[model samples]
Target: MEDNHIHSISSKSACKVTDDICLPDTNWPRLVIVGGGFAGLALVEKLKNKKVQVVLFDKNNFHQFQPLLYQVATSALEPDSIVFPFRKQFNGYKNVVFRLAVVEEIQPTSNIVRTNKGDVHYDYLVLATGTTTNFFGMDTVADNSLGMKDIRDSLNIRHMMLQNLEQAAITCDDEERDTLTNFVIVGGGPAGVEMAGALAEFCKYILPKDYPEYPSTIMNIYLIEARGELLSSMSDKASSKTLKYLEDLNVNVLLNESVSNYDGSKVITNRDNIIMAKNLIWTAGVKGQFPKGIDKKYVVRGNRIKTNPFLMVEDYKNIFAIGDIAAVITEKTPKGHPQVAQTAIQQGKYLGTSILNIIKNKPIKPFEYHDKGSLATVGKRKAVADLGKFRFGGYFAWLLWSIVHLMSISGFRNRLMVGFNWAVSYFTYEKSNRLIIRNFNKPSESKSTINSQPAVKKITIND
Candidate 1:
């Protein structure tokens, strides 16, 4: 059976001199959505069977489950378990088309989006480009440290970690071996905490058994945070418990200290500590990421676009911004809602309904975010959760966290695979997917190789 649902426009044809690649005529409004993250997917799901011809654009063809990316980095789960292809996800949506292209700029005056492939006109445009790793203007850190933003980054971390271990096993120099084994993670956010815990678990269970050549005691895992507490957004109880959990797992928690600089080998902090480590996983912060054409006035702190109560971008009714890239300021959320999956998902669903209301000439409702609580797991059975005033930390919280994340995953197959992996790891204490499929180099070495590639083309659907 031929798969006519998704098609790719070849690079040669995409680069042809044409005014605009012709699109199928439709009486309904054509909606162009930029991104395939949590918010964009939710919006597309809501617009299913609606009076709209939706075209979704993303550089990648898959929607990544970001919350569980750490597991991939630590080899706890394979990459396939956390990523779902867009074509498979929207196979039944006949009115929707998925394009794999890099959006260069937006021409708001003409309602056309200029991409690497070609120009695409739309009746309404939605920007859910999400956020990128923010280095806070620290060039040294940006150049030297590894980030956990995407699956590629996770795989790079995994490869670097295993490669470093392999090198440590062969090196005779004690200092070099120590640097190879030393792991420093900046930012005590959920990603950093989970990574630290996972690394510690590896040292405890897997390292001793798998790599007997190198002693596990020599390996050092450090969690650094500028703030005094971990999981600052959560309640104090949750924060304290999380700190305790990390300490119990033998992770060195550095509080109230900021990374001053990293020269690719040494991690220099504001305090007296200057640690040597080749691998530094940075999860400190993230800022809004979108293409050009949005006015500077509309962009606020953290590089986010200012959106109204209806999630429409300021000064443009037909353009909307949601997810981590949007700053929807309200009295309750003066600084905008926390950049979490729930916020994006809620806003996306609301914006979809609002678009339909606008089409029907009916009143549109404002978006209201209901806090669904927060959860963070440190080690196997050590976790913390904050639900309103109720706070809990222990094995129950870990189980609850696992169940919630498993249910939140995209497909049943992914959930089952992840559940099975967790069960196996629980009993056997092993991470089977540690193979380095591709070798990873430092950012400076890899940047030139990536820049040589041509622009991505679109994935077209048959009429």
Candidate 2:
């Protein structure tokens, strides 16, 4: 087969093709990747400048560093700091191209993907679409509470918190003030724990200084977990230490309790315990997110696509999945690999080489996951880590967490921005991005639903 065996519409004549996204003419096998999260980007990195022409499709053009999204939500860093443009990442990589479009459907039979912009054919397809916030089919909770799944969610949390605090200041009634100031974080996972810790810090360090009228205890931080302990995925030591860390920070750790319902202002737990809070952040669960056209038979628990050990969807040789969307089911691992950055990165890189070998008809081995340990931070100078035969917490663990995350960010400039902010906050306890530039309204309800419901009273600034 020669290089020109496959002919693509030239750049000048791309408009003539109906329902097709304009792409550079290429003879190399086109690898169409959906989503640009950890796994997809890893594959992109591995295949850059390779013989395969890669077309990366994502709704957002930037790659977000998810582990630190809590910081962004808590205003420790800006959105731009955690996001890197795909074009900037692909600079000098001639074989790679990125398109900003939402994939609406996957037509495996036609070897094409239909996006909101246009359709594009693929020689091979990979789904790294990742997961979205899972509310367990609770519409009320889904509408009222904020999720920590993306940069937008983080921004929403930040705005919700700031606006609620401002409302707390405006109210005359004590009960309404309490409802406005209290914070409820559902889920005992790493995200919820980190968010609770960060909010606790905000209440402790930033509240009294920013608002002299209110005491430091005006804001209450509650962390609710359905599980018996925090960080259930980690070892017993790590879990215990994490609980201790949050407790010391005055976070109301509610273990063995689940949120039964939330009506925008009140949190009702399964035990019938009621907590009044206007700001609720949900980090409880996530389900696979991808375009339609995937057979329901291949879908498993958590809505993930079932794939073989080689990372190929069962019965579909040319279609594959990676990252959070992929559930590689095997006897040893009945569910799937952990939906973490490490698993996704490894899978992406593995599949990169695997795809090239596949094109060349070379043999490939089964996909195997190597556990790289887990790290979760409660707040500044506090974290827990679980490594092989070694579990630890406190300052040293926090240091390890910081170093690992700093090195894991996408770009050097982003790394620098985060490192600088962390350094300033490590000593000063400062969060620089607290300005409420925009009013945030929940997607599911009217703006009035989130407003403070107490009677308004007039008080002069000096009064």
Candidate 3:
């Protein structure tokens, strides 16, 4: 069959609706993907030269390498090195069309998707919207702490840390200086562990050179976890080794503790323990983020859309879900697959073939996820890996982590830039340019700091 005969719509006419997004005229089956994360991009790659007209919608014009977001947050790498433009990625793929728009609603009955920019109809819809920082309804913590989910969030952290360190040097009061230099990181996951380690290294190496007035010991690093162990998702051996590595780097690891509130300067834990610090990083949890319109019953825990084994949304044949936003509910896998890059990538590839097969009226198999192991780095020359039966940590694991991440980045230029930066940092222990280009103030500090640079709060710690 010819491409024009695949759909009922004519190939010569454009979208006629007044609020419709302008798209190329095509009679091929329209595969509209709502996100450009790992899953969406993988699916796009699979259908590159195919007859399907792939339309990708995302809020940002670029796809972020989320695994290396911590490096960006800690100044080990520049933001651009880890984020690739969507247009650049779709250079050779003629069938793919990239659109920068936030999907507002999904009208399944009308086969249309409403967005902030305009609406676009889809023959087959896929939701790969991914996850967002989950504050767990703690408004105070959400307002004060920064979550390392996006590139902008990473930059905000860098600016906040640099600005605070500079303020610490200018303050004459001893108590205020301590609060400014102290860092509190909530969560013991990979992001939290890596962030704590990076901050500790910054305090150990950069603090002395940048600000010689204060001792490096003045900058304290803390990693707090609600659970008793770090990397609870990984092996016990990996967890113990990660904790040890952080401690060796002078990071105060606080286990079985959870943050209750944060009023910008003080971090109050559920156990009534208070830590006076101006900087707080939250890496605790994430919930799926997607547009409204789906039935409430289809939504499950973690705010994910419940889907069948074929990666299709329940009771909907044309609509599908993938990546972190999808919860493939089955008897064997109750909650769904792990919300990671590997799972997303695999699902995208599988669904790509399945969708094409469905279009051809062929048999489609169930989506199966193969566990590809996991790796988490603590600091330079320190990492833990759980590769099936082979569980290891330290130098070799760190090397494997480095290679895997370097090769996983989107563009060749980005990979080269990151590899070069890593090599330089490895030899000299020096980070990228630490410049504060923007003024990022927490919600509590925003009003007071408006019209002023950084409102250096001089609050005395209560004993």
Query: Would you list the rank order by TM-score, best first?
Result: 3, 2, 1
TM-score per candidate, in order?
Answer: 0.91, 0.94, 0.94
Worst 10 residues of 3 by lDDT: 446-455
- Residue 21 lDDT (model 3): 84
Give the per-residue lDDT digits (tens) of candidate 2, residues 1-463: 3446335423442322433788877667889999999999999999988888799999998999999999998889999999999999999898888999999998989888999998888889999999999999887788788889999989989998888888888989988988888888999999999999999999899999888888988788889999999999999999999999998998888899898777887677777677887888999999999999899999999999999999999989999999999999999889999999999999999999999888777898999999989999999899999988899999999999999999999999999999999999999999989988799985554334323433323211111
User: Candidate 1 — which residues are off by over 4 angstroms?
Assistant: 1-19, 444-463
Better of 1 and 2 by TM-score: 2
Question: Clash totals for all models, in order?
Answer: 1, 0, 0
Model 2 — TM-score against the truth? 0.94
Q: After superposition, how far is residue 314 of candidate 2 from its true place, in Å?
A: 0.8
